[model samples]
Target: MTCLPLLASASGAAIPLALIIPFVLLLMLIAVMPLMVAKVKHWWEHRYPFVAIGLGLLVVVYYLLRIPGGGETIAHTLEEYFSFICLIGALFTVAGGIHIKVKGSATPVGNIVFLAVGAVLANFIGTTGASMVLIRPWLRMNKIRLGAYHVIFFIFIVSNAGGALTPIGDPPLFLGYLRGVPFFWLIEHVFLIWLLVIGLILAVFFAIDFRAFKKTPSAVQSEIGESDTWRFEGGLNLLFLLVIIGAVFLPAKFFLREIVMLAAAAGSYFSTPRAVHAQNEFNFGPIREVAFLFAGIFMTMMPALGYLEQHGQEFGFKKPAQYYFAAGSLSSVLDNAPTYVNFLELAETTVRAEEPAAFAALGDEKHAAVRLLLERRPLLVIAVSLGAVFFGAMTYIGNGPNFMVKSIAESSGVRMPTFFGYILKYSLPFLLPILALVGWLFL
Candidate 1:
C-alpha cells in the first residue's frame, strides 16, 4: 500500500501491545509454514489464505468495535491495498503477454550484463515491472544450471536495490514524491550511493556465478557462449505497460488509477495471442497469493504503524545513520511504503520539536514542513528513503516484487530458499554488509 493515512488515534493514546499479536503470528506462519514436514507443508500451502484472512479480521473487528475513527482507518487501508494489488496485477498480466527468447544459454558474463540492464530498467518501468518483464528470460537463459542463488541475487539487484534512483523505481520513494519531495531529488542525492551499492552487489554475484560456471563441463560452457540470438514477441504489450506506469501519477480518489491499471491489463490480456501466453506460462496464481497475504499484512499492521507513530520520537533518533538503520530494520519485515511514511513523520516531528521557531516561520504553506526538512536536514530524508527501498531485499514479504518473484520461480521448478534461510544466507551475509558500508560512508 502506497499512502496509508497517519491515524488520528495515534496522537490521542498508545495502542495496546496485545493488538500486535496477530501481525507477529502471521509473520511467523509465513516464515515457518513452508519449512514444515511434507504433510504440514501441503496443508499450509492450501490453507494459508484462511489463516491470513482470519487473523486480519480479528484486528479489523477489534478496530471497528473498540477504537474511534477505526472504520475510516480500515477503509483507507483497503483502498490503498486495492491500489497496490491493481498495479501489481496489471504489471504481471502485461509482462506475461510479451515473451523474450534467447537461442543460447547465458554465460556468467552474459548473466551479469542482463542483471545490470535490469537494474537500470527498474528506474524507468519500476522494480515490479522490470522484475516481471525480465524474470522469465532470466530463468530461461540460465535453465541449464539454475540455482537458488540466481533467484536470490535477482531479488537483491533487480527487485530491490536497483530501484533507489527514482520515485517510480519503488513504492516508498513514490509515496515520498506524493508527499512533496521533488521528482529529481532522489537521483540528485542518492546516485553515487546507488551506484556503489549496485556495483558491489553485482560484483559479489559475479564471483559466485563464476565459481558455479567453472563447475559446468567445458563443452557445455562453450555451447553456452556460442550464439546469442534474441527474438521479441507481442511488442504491443509495451504500450499497455507504459499505460500502467503512467497511471501511477493519476489521483487515487475513487480508484481512478486502479481502474486504468486493470483496463490496461485486460486490454493486454485480450489482444495478445495465446501462443505468447503459453510460452510465458502465464497464470494468476502468483498475483492471487500476493493479494491474499498482503491483505492480512495491510490490515494487521495498523496497530504497529499506530504504535510507531505515537512512540517513535521516544527512540531518540537524531542522526541520519540512526534513521537509516531504524527504518531499514522495520522495512525488512514491514511493507516499506508505510515504514517510510512513519519514519518521515517521525523525522518531521523531531525537527519541529527541536526548532519550533524555524517551523513557525514557514506558516503552513503546503508541504512547508517537508520542504523545511529538506532545507535543514536533507540527509534524514535520504536515510529514510534509502533504508526503506534498499532493506526491502531482506525478506520475501518486505517488498511486493520479492514474493511475486519467489512464487514465479517456484512455479517454474526452481527451489527457492525458505523465508529465514533467505535472510541468514543472503541478506545478512551479503546485502546487510553493503548497506552498512553505505550508511557508514554516506549517511
Candidate 2:
C-alpha cells in the first residue's frame, strides 16, 4: 500500500476524498504490513498482488464508468507501466552480468571510499547502474562487519543524493534534459545543495560505521582474513550498458527505446557465461517483484495524477517551498520521473501565466529555459529537481536504485530495513533534519 498526491478534481468537479482511499490504503499497507504482520515480511515479493491487483481493478472500473478520459488514461498507464518495468529490468539484467571481485577485509575507511567513489560514479552511470556495479563488492567486503545502518546510509548517499549533479545521474534530471533544460544546468544550479547534503550524510555515516567497526567480533574479522588484488569479469556487458544508455535518449513513440533495451538485456543474457551470473548471483526475481508492484502503482496513480495536472494551481501552491515539500513528499512514494514532470508542468504553467513572451522564448533557444528559470523562478526549478531526487531516498520505492540496492543487499545476506522502518527509523530521524536544513538554506 502507498499514497501519492491526489488532485482536488478537474475543473471544479467535486471528486470525494474517499475516491483516493484505495491508493492511501495501499500505500499504508505497503508501509505498515511488513512491520506489523510477519506473514507480509515479503509482501512485495509474494503477496502484494492480492492488494495491488484487487485495488487496481477497482480503480480501472471506477475510471471507466465515471471519468471522461478514463479509457485513454488506462491505455497510457499501461504503456508507461510496461516502459517502466522494461527499462528497470533491462538495467538490472545488464548490470548483474558484470561482476567485480574483491580480495580484502572492509575497513571503515575503505568502505567509505567505496561509497564515495560510487557517489561520484552515479552521475555518469546513473544511480541504478552505479549501484549495480558497486553494491556486491560493497556488501561482500563488509560482510563480516555489516550493519543495517551501512545499507541505510548507502541508500541515502550513493543510491539517491549522489545523482544530483548531472541529468544522466537521475531520472528526474533526465526528464529536465528532455525538456529544454541544458545538460549542465542542474550542475550549475543544484551543485552546492548536492555537496552539502552528501557531505553531511557522509559525516554521519563515518561516525556510525566507526562505531560498528569497533564492535565487530574478532572471530568475524578473522573470517575476512586477508587482502589481495581486485578483478573485474564479464567486461563485454559494458557494451550492453552503453546500449541501454543510448536507448534512453531515443524517441518513445516508435517503441524503439523499449525494443533496443530488451534486446540488449537478451544479448547480455546470451553472451554472458552462466559462471558470471553465478558470481553475481543474478536472478530475475527482484525485477519481477518491482514490475508487479509498480504495475499496481501506475494503474492507481492515473486519476490522482490527472487531478494534480488539472487542479494543482487551484490549491494555491505558489511558493517554491510549497512545491519543494509537496513534490518531494509525493516523490517519496510515487515514481519521481512523472512526479518531476508533473511539478515541472505546474511550474511552467504558473510562470507562463505571468510572463507569456519570456516563457515562450524558452522553447526556441537551447539554454533559454535554464536562463529564464534562473532569472525568474530559480527556486521553483531547484525545488522540483532537488525534491524529486533527495526525497527519493525516503523510501525503498522512492527511486529506482533504492529498491535495487535493497534487493542486492538482502541477497548478500545483509538485513535491510523494512519500508516503514526505513521511513520512521532512518529517513525521519536522519534525512528529514537534513532536508529541513536544505529548505532553510536554499529553498
Candidate 3:
C-alpha cells in the first residue's frame, strides 16, 4: 500500500507515504536551503554552515541525553562516543593530509583516469592500500592545477563512490563479508549501480569542463607543452592510511603496538623518495583544520546513533531495499562499518515468525537465510549488505576514506561543507537521487 512509487522502489515493497512524505520534503528542504542562504548573505553565509551543523548536532546530542535507561544508557553512549573518538584520533595521528603525485604533466582527464585506476586498485589491495599508493600523486596533480574543480571532484566521486565495487573498497563491505555476504556477490549486484553513478559524474565533469572552456577562464586552462616536468613533491601520505586502518581493527592487547607502528609510518612518510611536498608548497595547517572540525562532529553524533539503536525498528522497514536506504542514509553521516553492524543486529530479529524448526534452524544466521529466502519472503540480509556498501556514498563519513577525500579536497581549495552540511549540500542534491534512481531502475 505504499502510495509513492519511488518510496516502494527504494524500499522494495509498499510503505505508507505518510511516513516517507515528510522525509522527502525534509530532503528537499535540506538540499535547497544552503544554496538559498549562501545566495543571500554571501558575507557571513559560510559561518552559518557551521552553525547549521551545530544545530543538527545538538538534535543528535539531545537524542542521546533523553534516553531514560540507567547505567546501560551511559554505557552505550560511552561505547559509541569512544569508537567515534578513536576513529578520529586514528586519522589525525596518521598526519591526515593524504594525497598522491602521478608522473607526467597532470590533466583533469589524466587525473580522472588515475582515480578510476585507484578505485579498482583500492578493492584489489585494501581501499587504504590503494589510497596510499595514489593520494600523493592525486595531491601532486592538484598542486600543479590548483583551483580546478577536477581535484576535489575526484576525491568526492572516486575516493568515496568509486570504492563501492569491492569489500576491500570500504570497511563496511569487508565487515559484511565477515557477517556472511560472499565477496563476489558485491561486484555482481553493485556493478551497475557503480557505472550509473560514475557515468553521471563524468557527464557533470564534461559540462563543467565545457563551460570552463567557453569562458576561457585562465585558471581552468590546461597549459600548452608547459615545462612537462612533474614538480611533484607532495607527502605521499600512504603510511598515514595504514596507521589509521590498523588502529581501527587491531586487537586491544596490541593498542600500544599500533600507536608505535603509526608513529613509524608517519616518520617514514617524511622520508619518501619523491618530493611531492614541494608541489603543495603549503604547510599542513589546512588539513589540520579538517581534523579539528571532524572531531567535533564525531563527539556530538555518538549519542544520536545510540538513540537510533533504541528506536529504529518503529520505522517499520521489512525489505532489503528499506534497510539498504535507511542504513545507508544514516551511514552517510555515521561511520558505515558500525552502522552496518547495527542494522544487521536489528535485522537478525526482523523475521515475523520463526521458520518451522526444520527451516527455522537456518534462521540462526538470517544473513545467510536471506540469500536463500527467494519468493518465500524478501532477503533482508542482502538488503543490509547492498545498503551498507552502496549507500556509504550517501554522505561523507559513511566510510573512512570519504573523510580523507574531503580533507584532501578542502586542502585543494574546494571549500567543502561541514558534517551535516555536506549531506545537505553534496549528497542530497547530487548523490541521493542518483542512488534512488539506481534503486528504482536496477537494485
lDDT of 2 at 105: 57
Cα deviation of 304, candidate 3, in Å? 12
Q: Please give the distance, in angstroms, between residue 395's alpha carbon in candidate 3 and its true position after superposition.
A: 4.0
TM-score of candidate 3 to 2 decimals: 0.57
Model 3 lDDT tens row, 91-174 = 333332443434544554665576667666655445544544465556555454444355445555655666676655665565
On lDDT, the leading prediction is 1
Error of 3 at 380 (Å): 3.9
By TM-score, how accurate is candidate 2?
0.80
Q: What is the C-alpha RMSD of each candidate to the true structure, in Å?
A: 3.3, 5.0, 9.5
- Judge candidate 1 at residue 66 and give its lDDT: 82
Query: Ten consecutive residues with minimal summed lDDT in candidate 1?
Result: 1-10
Residue-by-residue lDDT tens digits, candidate 1, 117-209: 999988876788788878988887888888999999999999999999987788778767766788789999999999999999999999999
Model 2 off-target regions past 4 Å? 1-18, 40-47, 61-66, 166-168, 171-185, 210-225, 330-349, 352-378, 395-429
> Which has the greatest TM-score?
1
At residue 222, candidate 1 shows an lDDT of: 76
lDDT of 1 at 28: 70
Candidate 3, 378: how far from true, in Å? 8.1
